[model samples]
Target: MADTAFEAQGESVEEVFRGATQALLESMANPVTVSGGWERAIERTDVDPSTLLFDWLSEVVYWKDAAGVVFREAPLTLTREGDVWLLRAGLIGAPVDQQTQELHADVKGVTKHRYELKQTGGSWKVIVVLDV
Candidate 1:
């Protein structure tokens, strides 16, 4: 199986999520060249933080393919309401430009293999594997 393992960490969940977003964006291209002219807002909910993150990253991949654009920025917030955790993000993107961007392998999807999210010592960390 062609896959890549990714790790991200931060002092808070929101910061950790942002790190994950950066890893995701970096996996596809050199983000410095993306420009981010297009914006797509996304909302995802799940019963737990780990699942919420899994679903959110999946949505990011969805937008990348569905909109024919590569993401340059992902600004988000994670909140809890009742029994569910909700995540909202503004995905800033730009169309795939070969001349101006440094492209990499196409990401197939996020995989459950060795997928993990953990918080310890007041800091949060996550590990995800992507099918590339």
Candidate 2:
């Protein structure tokens, strides 16, 4: 599989995170074919946004690697307290089945190289590179 990289931007933090999540799934499979058969809640806390984004994507990759589950939809909420940032995500998708869905690239992990998250002109933008 080839390396897949994409950038996502949104007016709010939640929207950007959601866009990133969708981009990840789309890289692996066609979004139209994947259905929401199961739901998983993921929670992570980090001292900074960059680490939070890395860890969040890493966890999502772990799910695909360990459980054969591919997440298609993510509704996320982010909150900050002091220096710690909390992320709560409700992810919905189904386990991989070759007969049911066509899988594309196998995302090995999320890379920190060139990874960035920032706000520009009142919108949040995130750049992510996935190892496939």
Best lDDT goes to which candidate?
Answer: 1
lDDT of 2 by residue, 1-132 (tens): 358899999998767887888898888887677788878888999887778877888888888878788766777888889999899997788988777777888898899867999899999999999988
Worst 10 residues of 2 by lDDT: 65-74
Sum up the clashes in candidate 2.
Answer: 0
Residue range 52-125, candidate 1, lDDT tens digits: 88888888888889888887888899888898888988999899899988887678898888888898999999
Per-prediction backbone clash count = 0, 0
Off by over 4 Å in 2: none
- Give lDDT for model 2: 0.84
Q: Relative to the unseen true structure, what is the Cα RMSD of model 1?
A: 1.4
| lDDT of each candidate versus the true structure | 0.86, 0.84
